[model samples]
Target: MKFQAEACTTSVGGPRWERRLAIERRRAENHARRGRRTFRLSRIFSLKTAVKLFLKLSRLQARGEANARRPIIRRVSFSFPNLPTSFDGFRILHLSDFHFDGEAARAVMIRDMLRGVESDLCVLTGDYLADYFDPLGRVYCNLATVLSGVRAQYGTVGILGNNDHSEFVQRFSDLGVRMLVNDGFELGIKGESIWIAGVDDPNTFECEDVAGAMRGASSGAFKLLLAHSPEVAREAVEADVHLYVCGHTHGGQMCVPVLGPLFLNASCPRRFGSGAWRYKTMQGYTTTGLGTSAIPARFNCPPEAAIIELRRAR
Candidate 1:
């Protein structure tokens, strides 16, 4: 039997081969350069930026985020003993925990929802941006569309939450929303007055000053406190606040049937963490909120913008 012998090219040193090798080398060099550049960036970056980058790159925005576009309006009314008779039936539109973080449809929904809403006052309780993914200072670019035409006779007031950067106060203020940082405002309505105060974020960063916010307001005066987290509820009530409003819990955004709250990052009691509850004489309300956080999808709990009416107790 005769076997055929096969010939193979042993010299890959031809001009064409040389050109191919050169191209391969360039690709390797580029890959190495990119890795080095990323290393340098990691070295100079703070933990915050690193975490944000990781979350943005690796996090999966869950489905049903579009459900976030249609928010329900929660209308709750309660009587306050000290609420002025003339101010009875005064309505407050509470918009909190927006978690805007650049979701266009949700932003547009907020804008449309408020178009037909009329209130004596408006309050924004924080978590303005979902996380660090959104570029700093751009949170309001879309929020302005929602807030511009909101009908509030007194004005809109805002406070920062754990998810917010300190500089956001001025940004919201620039958009005509009165941003209160550990401060108080005495608002007169119908010849009577109520004290509205806001505290800095106390849930994650712990910079709140409730006593400071209560300054200048009388002990017997009807007071409302705006906070980003219900964690501040105890502090506000201790400061002689008559009522408190906050968000951040998202009403257990995702809850198990009877077990409830897949996870609640807040320290407030579970019952008082979501809707209306009272501590001593102080009434507190926490909204499920208008948007989502971490993951855009919410299960069991639907998004909401709340309208709370204040009336005098008989």
Candidate 2:
């Protein structure tokens, strides 16, 4: 369903200047991607390129590519003491890192998975596109097709990731996904309510202000934080957020047998890399993601979309 901004109360959390700074930061990152610095500054590091080349030479690229198309529906449950009774059994459809332009089959897989899935809320943690240089028209067209399959009760909301550009905020908003940039909306049920706030890219852009994002919410409300990466876990905890959801690591994208992911690309601890973990009083879940990044492949780590059920702790 199309999410109407005015359907619920919204918090203009951060100041306009903060958003301006974030846009400028994104523009600078974009500028860095245009020249000889492109390979060095972007997600396409020499290591990832080398890994891709190795996979191609060893005939393992095809298997990894196949794995990318086969995403799993992960079911996770969390019980929170502050969670309102009305929100009990609330199912959150958490999708992230679509990288829509990467693989055509992934889109089809997502459409199939979302067919009968029902949720009270849907949150997209970002990395909607695979490459910064990809043509916007085709990329967004593919994205629109993928998003058309989503069915949620409250509606879908998203935040930007490192790979996303500033323009996508409006782009996603146009497509019925409310783009939260250091802002949020309140979901109310019979006078009981919770706040869903999202911050800008904290990993690459580093412009997130957790307290600013929680501006309009009450002190005791169950605050749900949406960030691109787990990098802001500590900040969310400091802001008194009850839950934090994000995705950027892609569950290591390419992992080994027991050693796990070779590179998480996230600043937080390894425990918070790709799944649910607790930080002080706040609980967070980082999805493995639905698509691959840097190199279009997956190893032992399969792609996934999370269906998180929130229960009020007795």
Candidate 3:
């Protein structure tokens, strides 16, 4: 028996199926290539963005550190319209928050700052030493030397802060720095009388009785209240105080770039952060302070000693 030969047709359908398969393979390969390209571009963009952000952050940090190291001095002058003729232009050098701790360099810098100013009186607000450590002994000695060099026609008056202990107060007293703790004194200058009063820190220890402190003061005398914290401005105003000088918040210590003070523990309003403020008949001035505390750094808020030239208002 013989088998017959069968004819197979390679027609349009067969080639079309092969072409479709080839097209599908090429499409898949192209898709994969596009996906890899897209992934590579995304990675590059992310890396570039991250690098830019890191550089920006570095610059900002450098700027902040630079500002912290810079010392910015603020000068404020006030005029009392009804000031007595004899006390017309009495200038005062207000320095506060020394926070000294065996750092003779800081003390010398302070002395240099005060040496250039010409004032009738120098008022030291408080915080003579940073803490109750043994190093504070050296700090006190250096501070005493600096205090002895401070020149004022009237005198150098001071008060204590929360960080100060009884021993510190005694040391200050020995240095000819009069300690005014919840007490008032009268300064007679050219027949004109000015009541200088100091109140204890209201936040830390309890020694502030503003009313009682000013009870013995003459009613007609111009009242100048030296307080460590500005929170007592209400009591001072109630006692008819004309001027209030304080330095506790450290002008928020580390002020933010655009946001201002990072943190202010003050009881007063935020607007009174580190400058002169007026409320009713009372004028409150908060210094940026002379030294650092807590964190030994300051940003936009720099250490300062104020020269407040009081002029008679026309």
Candidate 4:
């Protein structure tokens, strides 16, 4: 009887042990399934977060406000003490890359920016229109009207960029912008003689003759060169230009916060992407430009018009 009881107990104990093991296995599988589900949910949440951030940035840019405020017009001022007395304290309002479309509001915004600028000369670097040809002549005509309204003591001078084709060239000329293509002209500031030279787009559709532009320039006279791309800085320096004004890189168009411009399209080093850069005796000022390109959006790098004041160095 005791042997029979022992056999029964052994059989009952074996079945209970197997049942417990099966239960533990099922619990472990359920736990693993829950972990996988949690991980998937986490990934989904992260992706949603990234999408939300992108959307927020897009909304902010479209609203024309990055930080809950209207886009502030950036005013960059620079003083060059090495300027000659003839053009002492010559203030030049430099504007570039006005990619005007049929947007009336944009024109008004640009006009507002130019409203209170008091300068001796207005120099439009290039990239005046986004249109390939003068497809929208009305837009360019309106732009010229707004540009003509700017008050400058000397006058407004402009050059043709890669974007400005024959049609734009004519329209700009009609607007009273002295379009210089591999040409040099003299301007008198306070009875002091200075040379203003401009070259056509080098990398694009125009002939760039640095030598031709500076042919008649006097060595002693203050030389200001307007070449759209800062890539010509080396040539400008070799030509012994005092100041080189350009606006092609657009400060890399888009830049990361604090880290600044990611890439500069010009041949110059990335450090020369924006603001003022000095190579030997030549000073090159590359404006961030007044418009957008490729992406039509700006972050960290804002559109700007600079006022450069030249003064004789002590």
Question: Which is better, 1 or 3, measured by lDDT?
Answer: 1
Q: By lDDT, who's the top model here?
A: 2
Would you give me the overall lDDT of model 1? Answer: 0.75
Q: Quantify all predictions' global Cα lDDT against the true fold.
A: 0.75, 0.83, 0.71, 0.68
Candidate 3 TM-score, C-alpha based = 0.76
Which parts of model 1 are misplaced by more than 4 Å?
Answer: 1-63
Worst 10 residues of 1 by lDDT: 1-10
Clashes of 4: 2
Q: Candidate 4, which segments miss by more than 4 Å at Cα?
A: 1-82, 131-134
In Å, residue 67's CA in model 2 sits off its true spot by: 0.6
lDDT tens readout by residue for model 2, 3-32: 774543333334553665566676667777
- Higher TM-score: candidate 1 or 2? 2
lDDT of 1 by residue, 1-314 (tens): 01111211111233333443454466458767774245566555765355345445665223345555568988999897778887899898999888877756667777887888889888899888877435665577777877865788877888878777655655666677777777887888667788888877778767677888888897688899998888877677678888889888888776558888755678868987688989886899989988777556666788998999998999
Model 4 C-alpha lDDT per residue in residues 1-314, reported as the tens digit of each score: 01121221111123323443454466558766774245566655664346446757668556433421123445454445556677767788888877665566666666776787787888888886665433466567557656755777776777767666534445565566677777777786466688888887764643566777888877776789998888777788888888888887778766778887755667777767888888888888888887765455666777887888776766
Q: Report the number of the highest-TM-score candidate.
A: 2
Write the number of the candidate with greater lDDT, choosing between 2 and 3: 2
- State the TM-score for model 1: 0.78
Worst 10 residues of 2 by lDDT: 5-14
